[model samples]
Target: MPDYKKNSISLTGAVGLGTGVMISAGIFALLGQVAELSGSWFPLIFIIGSIVTAFSAYSYVKMSQEYPSAGGIGMFLVKAYGKGTITASAALMMAVSMIINQSLVARTFGTYTLQLFDGAQTEWLVPLLGVGLIVVSFLINISGNTFIQTFTSIASLIKIIGLSTMAIAGIIVADFAFTIPNKASNPPDIGIVSSVAAIALTILAFKGFTTITNSGEEITKPKKNVGRAITISILVSLSVYLLLAWAVSSNLTLSEIIAAKDYALAEAARPAFGDFGVWFTVILAIIATITGIIASVFAVSRMLAMLTEMKLIPHKHFHMPGSIQKHTLVYTVVLAIVLTVSFDLTRIASIGAILYLVMDIMIHWGVFRHLRKKVNANPFIVVSAIVLDLIVLSAFLWVKFQSDIVVVVVAILMITFIFIGEYAFLRKTSD
Candidate 1:
């Protein structure tokens, strides 16, 4: 019996925003990395991961119905398990993780936007523009939910138009067989490592469903709609990922994809429609990034508010003064700091990915165990999901361990805050 509005998101709005939110992170970015990691098995890994994520969608959908609140992972953890402090702290981490993930993706969108500007330093200019976007989005968010929702709907449409155009052109023009690894890797050396690394990065593409859970409170029909939203949105996004992988992999040699990879959407489109391809993708990336920034900052701030509700954080530092409009600025400002400081999508994405997977595992096991008490389900399915989640997580860690110091530090800093918040503050509050 929450006092919140019951007019949940329509299936249409949910699916559209879900798709808009996911496409930018997954397709515009992750393909090249996955291509490198999966080696000959790139397509296989994605197909497999998509299946799990699809189920992951179902699992969370169930959790959403059981605990219908805006808290998302926090609600799932605290309500189901009655471990308020732990989940409250976890909610804080989820908030930061969303900021990192969203800002990184938005900045990448910035990178693509700079391509549209002549005489612009694509590298630095992209991040600077991303900073500007974060600022603008903050103002929009603090304005009100009506503004955020309306704006996101428009952003989603822009994304659909841009991505749909690419997908259509690719299917008609590109050949999948060309990119499919014809021969199995006889003995892929350190290349195997790269493929695994790619899985971690690419997982970010499939990472948007959880955000729907963040807005669970707003959903018109929590049980029915939220589940459908999470599942359908992910399935929709994953289908495109498969299409893009085939489209990009099918048409271009791995080396060529790598060479023209950042602009892979444009590169893929070139064969189908030369010169027009560049503008087409540039337009899509811009639309996708703008919406992603809006959707993400709004969602993350709501998640932080959940922490306050449970007394995990003092309500004052993070309070929603009116209908979520109050905290959007705070979330946007944090996003600005991350984007302006760096366009290290890889590191920020990595840390975000790790937190997401860890949260997924916690919720996955938490819910499955709860169900086991009442009814029987396959241990194998649960075990397999767990194993695959680890494999995905391990692949990420393996690559992350070797490459960057900063990625490790940022992840550690975020994690350290979670632990301290849980043991020190959450514990004291409970006592």
Candidate 2:
């Protein structure tokens, strides 16, 4: 067994890790998608999303304070459900969702980078760039903890400053007024259902805070700093996301935003700062996506490795390895690459949102039903988290069903497969 590198990550590093994932391609890619669903008032969706995520974070923060471990949510699930199918499947779902996010960010990297080049053939170029990014991130992960922390921290700072500057500048250029330029093709009025559905993506955008919990044991003060890091990261992310939403909405009309949904940030830059602004936004996207993948792969591979140690999941070295962590790193990057090549951004985001929300509900329930007392959690907050997730998830599924039945079907099948497969594995292992 390799050292878990306890006390290796400082609180600042943990915040960097969390915001690295949270601030990444999320704002860059998902803004337009959320706008498409919620219309002109998409920025409000982020506010609502943050409220729901704050409730969800309560379960995780309480759990980490009580039982901090390198295993993170995997450990939390096991404590609540024991070493059973529910524990294994939900943990796997969370792991897969994180990997799905990696692919989404990687693809966003490709999309934003190509904005610098006109008439680039996205058919091959996008996935090619995405795969290249995953490989680079994998190499960075193998360099160990100190470098990863340093790199992500610096990258996080750069993107935050850059994004904040761009957002403020765009808002100023728009003179603090946001209106759809093309009234003829104005977006439809946002309804209750649409607004709720848009929260799913905003939730997904904020979900990066979970990366902090995953690295709980590595932080300097596991019990105290873990919760603090989660809180600070969420608050920071909320501020940045709101600025970004307003900035983009101010610059681009609903139609323009939807058309350039994948590269909306760069598109938003054009009306404000012209080609130079586009270049600046693209550079920031590159930094955010790269650091996002680095931090995510770090936390996710560790979580999966912990599951293997618990024998909750099977593993194979296949004649190559330095440690279980290394093997899992390889596995994590491979899965991300596969998904990057296979799915479009919309499908990837949808699938990730569904998986994450379902797993989030399970975590809240686990704490609410079983560990709430032990962890000293508030029952009202836990129940509110569950209810909010259910509402947003139900709305998201209904909207996807109406527009893209394939995304909903794929999510259901993936959940089914994870649960069924984990049950068989646990049953066989017990036997």
Give the candidate number with the greatest TM-score.
2
What is the lDDT of every predicted structure here?
Answer: 0.67, 0.93
* TM-score between candidate 2 and the true structure: 0.98
For candidate 1, give the lDDT of residue 372. 32
Instruction: In model 2, state the lDDT of residue 2.
Output: 60
Q: Model 1, range 1-431, lDDT digits (tens) per residue?
A: 24234564556666655776687756776665566555655766677667767656656676677676776777777754665655665666667666876777666776676656557364666667767877777777666555666777777766766676577567667542444634442224436656656666656777777778877888778777888888787777777777667766666666666555455666766677776776877888877777776777767777766656566665443534554325544754775566556646555677778877776676667667665333244446656666667887777776777776666667777787777767787667767
State TM-scores per candidate. 0.87, 0.98
Tens-digit lDDT string for candidate 2 (1-431)? 26589999999999999999999878999998998888867888899999999999999999999989888999999999999999999999999999999999999999988998876474879999999999999999999899999999999999999999999999899898865445444566557797789999999999998998888888998999999999999999999998988899888888899899999999999998999999999999999999999999999999999999999998988999488989999999999999999999999999999999999999999999999899999999999999999999999998899889999999999999999999999999999
Alpha carbon lDDT at 141, candidate 1:
66
lDDT of 2: 0.93
258 Cα displacement, candidate 1 (Å): 2.4
- Number of colliding residue pairs in model 2: 0
